[model samples]
Target: MSDLIFYTNPMSRGRVARWMLEEVGAPYETVVLDYGTTMKGPDYLAINPMGKVPAIVHNGRAVTEGAAIVAYLAEAFPEAGLAPTAAERANYYRWMFFAAGPLEAVTADKALGVAPTADQQRMVGYGSLDHVVDALEGAVKANPYIAGDRFTAADVFVGSHIAWGMQFGTLPQRDAFDAYVARIMGREAAARAREIDDALMPQPVS
Candidate 1:
């Protein structure tokens, strides 16, 4: 029996988990869910009560959140070499959650044009989008990967955010982000993941 069951919607954040799965090089089944019905149904909600995409079940256990799934897959499939070393794990975790938390929230806020002001920033977790973007640029520019020279699950999580940020124009263009994304896009595994998800996505009505 297959131990890993991946549940996703091609148009959603599940794309991030899919890329990590490809990097893991593991066999898994994909269960596609819909936004209106299937995803909010009781069965799917059992896996993630939040009714969110990008949930994975492995060894009879379910994991939700794209970042969590990516991190879990790295440990679950150690042979993929996607897990960070002990010494580099701190940085790996720091930047990984940074993307999942601050980067994610700030970008959305920026896109919505409701970002918190400088004084209000302290109360919010992201502390403003500009600070978040500047910090991320520095991190990517200084290190080839979030954890160091090695491409760990951190890259899969954090890197995907950068890719989407740049593509959607939510984040400003930066030489560092561009170079980092170029390197990640060069991987065949990344290519395969993109192909699979793109194929599954529904065509726009317009």
Candidate 2:
């Protein structure tokens, strides 16, 4: 068996984890899942009952969810130096969860054309789009990256979302976001992942 096994669909958030795998320079086996067919297979469900993409089996343990997977990989392979010092732990954890929660919520809202009323804003953890965007702006603006100058896995989590948003025209084309993506995408690992996935997309179906 391979040292690592990754379950994913190119069209899903799994792309984020795929980028991270490349970041760590880890050799992994991939099982590409179709929309609804093979992902839910009994064997795959044993790894992730939710049938989610981006789930991984590493060294006999299962890790699921994009954020968790990124964190796990960073910790699992410390040689990559993708995590931060203990002093940076708070921001490290905060941004990862924030991306999965607030970032996802606000981006989804923008995509659906739904604006929250003032009262409704309080009910949501993100509060408002302006609040969420401003928070992201402050973090990246202060440092070249989210978790300070180091290109930690946290950037992979939040950066990928911002990159996707920009690519699809769902996010603003601010210079900060543009520069942030350019920095991350310029990494050799990120480029390798994109190349591999792009090649996979053009292969003939069996």
Candidate 3:
């Protein structure tokens, strides 16, 4: 058995971690857990108390959260060169957390029809979905990649959010976002990851 084990459901945010795993090109054992079943079972919940997919267990050490998983794999397998350089570290962390925190918060709020009133904007971390979207657009527009000129683990987390946002109508489609998605999602590793998840998706009953 591979020392690295990935627990995921193809339809979940686990796709982001899967992409990072492919980018690292490391061998990992995949355990597909269905929603509300194995995912919430005692055994899996022990690995991730939140009962979330996209967790990884490496050498018996469990790392949960999609963003952390991406970052962890990048460092764990340095040969892949996915970790940010010293120069790129600032933006690397900045954007990755931005997506995980504000961007994700606002998008989920929007999806659930929970828009905050203007007076409550300050109370919420993201303020508003439009505000988060504008900030994200500027970030991606400023750099070819999230960290800098080269792709890093940050892109796996941030880029996946952007792609998912656009596809699900959580984020507005703009030229900058479109171009940025084209640039990063075009990666061979991204394609491979998508193929893997796509194949795993439940087939429509004919």
Candidate 4:
């Protein structure tokens, strides 16, 4: 039996974990959960009290949150080269937390039409949605990946956000962002993970 057990609903942020797992090349058993009853059921809740998808149990330890899971797997499978060295780890952690924090918060606020005013923006973590977006654009423009030239687990988390943002108009478009996403999408592991999740998506009634 594989040491890692992944509990996820393919339609959710579990997609990010799935992509990270594929990149790690670790053998894992997937326990798929349904949206309503299944995800809220006792068994899964025992695993994640928040009733969230994309939680993974590795060596009897449960890990939730997409960015954390991605980072965990990178360190667990050091051979994958998805984790950055000590010198570069700060940047890696910087963008990962940036994605999970300010960027996520601002984008969510924007989507819900609860945008912060100029004064509120200054007091907020992201400063403003535009500032967050511009910062990300400048980072990726400077290097092919979030941590630097080398691809790391940070990209899996941040790049996914960037990809979805660009696709859904949640983020502004830029040539550097476009090329960066194209490169991330080009990975065979990413392709496989997406194909698997696409198949998992619910189909129309016959």
The clash count for each model shown is 0, 0, 0, 0
Question: Mind giving the per-residue lDDT tens digits that candidate 2 earns over 1-206?
Answer: 99899998887888889999999987999989876788888988999999879799998999999999999999999999998888678788988888899989988998999898999999878898778888887777988878787889999999998899889876777889998999998888888888877766746779
Best model per lDDT: 3
Candidate closer to the true structure by lDDT (higher is better), 1 or 4:
1
- lDDT score of residue 99 within candidate 3: 97
The alpha-carbon lDDT assigned to residue 140 of candidate 2 equals: 77
* lDDT comparing candidate 2 with the true structure: 0.88
- Could you give the candidate ranking by lDDT, starting with the highest? 3, 1, 4, 2
Q: What is the alpha-carbon lDDT of model 3 when measured against the actual structure?
A: 0.95
Candidate RMSDs in Å, in order, are: 1.4, 1.9, 0.7, 1.2
* Residue lDDT tens for model 3, 11-116: 9999999999999998999999999799999999999999988899999999999889999999999999999999999999999999999999999998999989
Q: What is the TM-score of each candidate against the true structure?
A: 0.96, 0.93, 0.98, 0.96
lDDT of each: 0.90, 0.88, 0.95, 0.90
lDDT of 1 at 155: 89
The candidate maximizing TM-score is 3
Ranking by TM-score: 3, 1, 4, 2
